[model samples]
Target chain A: MDFTAILGAWIAVGLTLFILSFLYRDNPLFKIAENLYIGIAIGYIFSITIYNVWIPKIYQPVSNRVFTSLSNWVPWVSKFVTPAGDAGSLTPLFPAIIGISLLTRIFPKISWISRYGFAFIVGYGAGLAIPATVATMFIAQIEGTIQPVFKLASGGAIDLSGPALWTSFSAILLCLGVIVTLFYFFFSLEHGKISKKVTKIGIYFLMVYFGAAFGTTVMGRFALLYGRFFDLYTYRTSGYYHATPILILLVLIFFFVYFGKSRKTSP
Target chain B: MKNGKIAAAVLAAIFFASVSGASAEKKKIEIPPLEGLTARDMPYDMGAAALLEWKIRDCDNQDMTYRIFVSSLAGTGPALRSFTEAGWIKVDEFKGNERLAKDIELPFWAWNASKNIHAVKVSLDNFFGKIQDGSVYYFKVMTLRGKQISESPVVPGAVKGNWFNLSRFNNLFYVILISMAFFWAVTHAKKGNLFIRRITGLDAVEEAIGRATEMGKPVYYLTGRLGMGSMSTIAATFILGEISKRIATYDTQLKVPHTEPVTMTVCQEIVKQAYSEAGRQDAYREDINFYVTDDQFAYTAAVDGMMTREKPAACFYMGYYYAESLLLTEIGSHTGAIQIAGTDAEHQLPFFFITCDYTLIGEELYAAGAYLSKDPVLVGTLRGQDIGKVFAMAVILLGAIGLTLAHVRGWDGLTRVIGNLFNSF
Candidate 1:
């Protein structure tokens, strides 16, 4: 392999190992990796948001839309195209002001200015979420819930009831599950014997749902673990030099600890 | 200039000749018409999507691939040529009888009643930028083989940009009805009409802290990686306030490693206020509740390190979480801490349930504070949510019974009518 590719691969393997080292015990290697990742992520976000979001969405559009170049929102492609001269509109300044005010929180004397930004964000977000949540979650869920239990025959008569009996049973069970689950959270009524029975059934659904979710989560976590292990295995199985960084970094960490402890000579 | 124009003409001639194949000079290919061509506005959306559909009549062979073209105005080939220049803007290209993703939003075609077919629908938003809502547009599906092409009859269509989409009216009804229920409950909360069953997960908040005090180690509570504006983080702050007060009374330390500066500031104030209220204001430490980076996984890694090194007696994870939920919870488990977690994030709750001493699933996380303090506003909202649940259960029960009966009785008309009503925009 070429030097750049090999070097990049080695660095990735090193970081992965460092992070995975936490499973053994928390140490300096994991600390360094965690800090590096955080630093890189912070820098990456700042740069990306500046070029991709603020410059295109706010700065360019508002500075003068007539000359605003709205091309290549991604940084990798930087060609520019300006809006037509008739695009002069200052409506974008309102949000720009709110964006700028958020930075004022850094200064204690003028930190109150940040509250305006927060208020705008919270108010606007709450207002937007009302319709969005209503439409996407509430209305959509209800619509999805109301459906035909079985596919009908061409003659429109309940054709072949024997085959479809299980389906009808399952549909009824699903409805019961929904009702009992809803009853599980009801605070108005005390859990008497009947309510307790209903809530118990509801808990069964909740547990089943949680179990399914947990099963999915286990697979997801495994997929991630597999990805990290894949990288370490991919590199080490290839050649001796690829495993050089892994061995050296690990040895160096222990080397410092061993020598430092011996030099202290407290014993 | 003369040479350039000549070269351009030559290029154009070659393009057309190549598109139609060598047979274009002699006998033109007699392309057959497309079957069951139709178009409609995509429902339950923000008027930027239109579903154009057609059957592949000529897909019996491997010679052709289909292409879909769109036009805002019809009978304007010259302008269309200027826009695309090569010909039509090919929105899609598919070989053979490859079917598109099926959409339940569209009504079943009358022609397809006899046979099962791949029902493909395309949304305009995917192909084009926000085209004006309610503006009339045109579509044509073309078939191409060996430079030969067949164009379907142009069909006119428009997406309706609406102030409020009627497709999700049921959801709005639910929201309003639920909100009203909450308002009613809040108004009557003092009257002692609402009866909330005990939540064991919430009750353990005190016990978790007490365990930390006995172990003589710090109690760690990090609201997941979310901004101050998020509802989960806001709720987390509320629960953190209660936890802080309880810990303060015991003179036990509370560590809050916040990701957002603003959230940290709010949390600091909340914890300080809680400590002050508990009459142990002097015991509260400002450094214990400090700012951490906003990078999600990085923050998670930092917390993992803390959990491993410090071995906090109790680790309380509350608020929103993503993949890091597993990392935090796994580390907490290994550290042998009494981990009490609560979150509305359903995906993370399962992991927490399997790992933590006690877990609050979904709405129970939100209800934790109300369950603890019996605050009228919080309790009222919880009660209100229960009423909303009742409405949902009633509707689901009735709908299921009716649909099942109709299916069992073979009443296809009722099925179609009600199904269409529920599914319609």
Candidate 2:
């Protein structure tokens, strides 16, 4: 509503139109917008890492410790120190050292030393991941998959009712899906006549899963598209002095002129 | 008038008797006692926390609520003498039948499997600034029903951390089993007896490269933003090595655009070694492997622009991809390039499947390295992993059957025993 806000909306509308121009064809406007997006994203991530990771984990801790220790030596120095609750531990230095060692890759002579850091990282990650993967992905998955298909009826016989039968059928199908899917990925086993049929069944299950996932993701993409279009429509209001329509009209003209001239220039 | 007076007197007498009978019932009500009350240091964790457990003698009447209180000894010996009721602060309160021991999700080995018992955790550090290991703490459970209250005798507990968690024993057993399997398979593979089934995606990689060679266009390989620590990235690099070697033999230009700088450096060495192995080191260029920005969509956009401009004949997207999977593959699809993608990211597989010519789902990506290299040692690991999967499948089938039988026969104990085998912790 204010001048700066209106100006911001205009800029946003202009960038959005420029980006959307990529759907038409690659042009200077799209390239400019792409480069700006990348540049701004990189800068934003850099500042975020500095504030969130480096300052809190490394800089503040080390500085607080140093200032606290210095303040203990001179009473007047207390005023200069940040109000840290306690003298921070030097434990963060160990990881900080490892992190700095990673930067040694930039130097050719000491690049090999970075291998120690890489080994530490990879070793620690594997050691952590292997157990978790076995537990959550392997054992827990097995536990969740092997549900009881047969339910006891109130008369103490296998349930024959419609709802119970459906439940049992679904459970059996799930179990079958798991078995066949696992068999499909089996490399050591030869896919003979019967094996091929089983694997085919497995492929059907996988296709179903992939199809469901694809449909869901398409819906998500459409939602994103809808959001962008809604923003464009909102900006067309007089509150922003019809910024969307103006920028879109300009982008359309530029696309036509650019494509027409490029076509003429081509041999 | 006489009949009315007699009827009213009888109604008044009946109402008074019913009211007195209700009052008698109220007077006869008694508070249920808390039983089997115990407090101890919680197992499989660092010191400073205690587990309090008790059972209400009669919980069928669900109106009862419980309050748990804890009081910590300030110091050892004489310091403990100063402990008073003021030190006992309420830690938790819950309605009856809530916070049952069975609701606590500890593995069977670590948990006391009493479903009827109430379980509550008390942290000693909540009272003391920093609790010492083996510090003595006392806890009490009080039951409140209507206006009636009954308290359990205070029990002393000592907090001490355990060295090992027995709850994760199953996980450890599986890890060891797979490791042993790997070693045995590797030794056996030395005899050249292992058979790894054909992965059609790896086979397609050759045809894709041939197409690129004939078209005289560069082949692009993009590794997603995961570092060397990721298994998928390592596998991708192995496949890259194999792919690069074949490309060297064909004398086709190959470009690897990396999101992570470390992966780029590693791939450079891998490609160099591959070229040397192919006896085409002279054709290898240092610029083959290059760094791109680590941001996901930005990298995808940059690659999209490049793909549109050059219209590469073949694109290989490997390693762990996120939302960028579809973005890159969709653009490559537009270019009509033969896109082959391999990744362990399950969610991104849908995107790759729809857009790419060849897609490797889940473990197929892990197997791509060994399949392409035909290295017996790596092939042996694949056999070992397959053995593990077969073991898993057998267990799933057997467990399902056993559980189904247990359900039909009403064997709850057997059901639990079988179910616990597959529980993680």
Candidate 3:
């Protein structure tokens, strides 16, 4: 095996053991591991943001295409421009200008400029999300409720047959229940008695839904635990000699705790 | 001498008889080979799945491992050659890194080479590495022995592709939703404003403790099984510190039974600190907070028993709960005690709504400590969370409008542009 593969395997084993230290009790070793995890995750996020967002969205566009095109068309512009200039260089400068305004928030005197960047981003995001939410969450849910329950026995079209009719009736009832319940939360004024009663019933339905959701959350948690157990068992039985690492780590933890206490007392 | 000789003789005869009896019990019979291999479309869910089942050989061990192989109709040699060649493209090549047993679900993409393929092979590996992939793959499976392969592999039966990739857009939507929530939370956190949070359940905590003190009874608190992720523990810590001061002044009892050892230790420290602050440290008992079992159901059952026996005036169910929520709540209800429950577990909210006097919903649990302590850090984080929610709602709204308008106008380019903008966030 290559060095990378061997090193990766060892790191996985070490992390597993580090996390498992909680089974004994939380200690400095676990704290160290936890801090290390936070540090690595933060580092990864920064790197990815730079690579995926900053570079492609800002630097590369300006330095390559825009500046090159601009300098080629206006050779005299090269004398005034930095080496980073490209074709249509002024096009990329717009985003940089906005970015600089965002950074201005750090300076007390120029903080007002930052509001422009915030307004643009917030406006753009709000404009994109509002319609999608209405279409998917509101419109689609309503449409689903209105779905016809009856089908023709002959497989041609709607049959007003007994089973089909009953199904359609139930569907209508469900749709009505959800709509009235939503109306219950319309807080323009103290709800009328009928609205209050409808809302109370709606609350019951909400509870039932919430209960099911809780069960799902529990199952997800159990799935994570099961995945961890699977990893432990697989490594153990596959002759990976996982026990030695666990044992060594435990000893080291005990020693650290002992030494920490002793130093505290001595000093 | 005669006695010793007789004893030895008897022992030998008993050993001989037992050995013979064991041998006589062993049965030998001819076992049938595997038959009727079939693959059919899996239904009622995603379409990209298929079910594979087989009638096992009579000699198959319950723990026996099965290796399934698929080949094209062209020939076994060609199929094996293709499979070997396409090794790099397989998504789950790493699954073979360790030993696996029993039925395996092979993805449709694994057999990409001839669309119309013939014959599947299955091998039982324990005994003689019985190659059952093709009934005629020049390999036979016997109990524990095999002969050298001297004949060509077999080719059998035609199969069709019955798989498709399921709902790529839906998966993308889910990823976007999660990332948006996380990003919004983080972004708002970076700002120094305290997030506004509504928690009606927390409003009742002081009253509940006061009622217990007035009634001259103890307040019982049980943190759920989740050791660290237990928001209940955090809530319990903050709430208990407040309650402990009242308890010290009123001289009422407070009992906390914890399932996790670490939580038990933390609870002790919190209670002691609270009492010390209240100038009633002498009244504090460390034993009041103690470890139970790590087993989920067992811990709940024990807590139920404690509630019945002690009959505390007030019981707090805070944190994560699973199947035991109903049982605990019902027991607490039966005891005629005031029950206040708070959990983010949406499934258990219904039970709490019916049984408990007050219930904390999702995000409300996180806000409880902040509500009680009014710590700037906690308040700030909560404010951040609210901002995130608002941000998320805005994004959802805008995306919906853009997509709808694009669809209505039959502007595919516009739709792509809008979709890309949504993704960039």
Candidate 4:
């Protein structure tokens, strides 16, 4: 292996072990790894915000034109700072102001100013989602469900041909599932005999869905575990020389961290 | 005699040109008049695009090629003849014989105009240069045969954007219907008592907390990454308040580790409010509910480590979770805690199912607090949702039967009628 590949593998193995140690118990090594993970994650997110959010939303638009012929006043600076345009539209300023206002919440004296930011977000979210919710979640979903559950015969009878038979049957099943699921969530209605039967049928569909979901989730987790195991197996490189030291380190951890803890005086 | 014949021929050509100056250039060919030339401005948009459509006059003519030309602010009649340049978008070749050209990449919009006619929809987003709304434009389709040229009448079109789209009238109708149902339910709920079916999952909430109190271990509540403006988080917050109230009476600690600083602040308030309401205000501690790192997996690791070391007797996994669902729950389970998880994250449901003792799935999590609280405002909302479902059932049942009847007995005529009826949204 090259130096970079060898170094990357070593770091990965070391961090994985540091994290995995928590399965046994939380120790100084685990804490160090956890802190490092948080620091790196926060640093990465900050960079992304600058690259994705701040530049596009705030910096470039304002620098291009601060509402007037501000760029023309300083030719040297404007040549470097200004974007190629007559004047940038002032619409971007609203979001920029709101974004800056979110930081004001940290100051107790003027924290109430942040309410405008929160209010804008909440109001915008509600306004945006209501129409979308009605269209997609309510209408479109119903439209999908309400379509013909069975195929009609040429003479106005049901189609029983092999492919058509399965298609029509599954459509009927889907229609049933939708109806029963809706019925199951009907809190205001008392579950009388018919309602009970319908809701019970709903339960069957729900169980099948949950079962399939569980299987998929297991497969996903197993895939991740498999990937980690494969990475560890690559340590067999350089004629098995690295494997011996790694095994010895694990042995030391078991002896000192696990058994040694037990040997301490009773609390 | 030959010069006299040429003079007579020139005189006939001049007479043809004077009748209508259809040609300024060299050759003139008889091009068929294009059919149904129209432009439509898309509704509920920012006045950005215009739809241009024209039927193929004689699509079968093997020797002819068609080219679409557009000019901004090109007027009608004599003024149009004076206009010099007609910027052409594309030229389609007549491939000849029984073979037809394959369906090329079409410019897309919310919906295509129709199937029978040839269509071209243009907007600022797709058109070559500048296309401003409210500006008058002209379109003409030309026919070319060898070196000869023939052109369609100049058709004027202007884009008109609307604030509300009539195409989505059904969507608005649906919204109105639900709104009426909600308002009626709320008004009626205010007047008198109404029946609410019991949600049994909520019963586990109290039991889990009670078990923790008995063991004298703190109850841990992980709200995942559900922040403000999410219904799931709001519901979880309500449930957290209730849990806190119960735990306060028993003098047991409620530990809430939040990933978001904003959520942590809100949770702290909810916890304090619960203690105050329970008449155990002295028992409330601000430090018990605290902010953790906003990092996704890092937050999960912190919670997992805390679960291992502290071994909280009751673990509440609420709001939304992604990959951390299994990790947190598995770690909590290893500590032998009574874990109750409620989330709207569908993909994380299966992981929660295996590890958590009692799981509230999908909409169940949304309805938990409303059901538990029994407040008229919350209950009224649930009632409205139920009413909407009934409306949906009626629509679906009727649509299904209508479609089936249309499909069967080879009555395709029934489909067109019903399709137009149901396709408003």
Best by TM-score: 2
Evaluation by TM-score, superior candidate among 2 and 3: 2
lDDT of 2 by residue, B307-413 (tens): 99999999999999988898899889999999999988887899998899999888998899889888899999998998899899999899999999999989987
Q: Which candidate would rank higher by lDDT, 1 or 3? A: 1
In the predicted model 2, the residue pairs found to clash are none
* lDDT winner between candidates 2 and 4: 2
For candidate 3, lDDT tens digit of each residue in B266-380? 5666788888988998899877787655656556655666676677888888877777887788878887888988786667777788789988765566567767766555665
lDDT of 2 by residue, A7-73 (tens): 9999989988887788877899988888887787778888998999998888878878888878888
Please write out the lDDT profile of model 3 over residues A1-267, one tens digit for every residue: 455754555566566666566445445555555556645655666688799977777777767675666778998877886554333244767867875776674586987787686566445544555445434543344334443334445654456788778976776566556655454333212456886787688777776677777677667768977886676565553255564456456657786876679779995
User: Model 2's DockQ?
Assistant: 0.66
Residues B210-329 of candidate 1 have per-residue lDDT tens digits of 999998998999887777656677778889998898999988878999777667867877898999999998998878688667788888887888878899999999998888887899
Question: Model 2: which docking level applies?
Answer: medium
Listed in order, each prediction's TM-score against the native is: 0.75, 0.88, 0.39, 0.81
Tell me the alpha-carbon RMSD of every candidate.
9.7, 6.7, 24.7, 6.1
Q: Give the interface RMSD values of the models in order.
A: 2.8, 1.8, 13.4, 2.6
lDDT of 4 by residue, B155-180 (tens): 77777666765656666667888999
How many pairs of residues in model 4 come into backbone collision? 1
Off by over 4 Å in 3: A1-3, A20-26, A70-92, A155-166, A188-197, A237-267, B1-425
Using TM-score, rank the candidates from best to worst.
2, 4, 1, 3
**Chain A TM-scores, candidates in order:** 0.82, 0.93, 0.74, 0.84
Interface RMSD of 1: 2.8
Ranking by DockQ: 2, 4, 1, 3
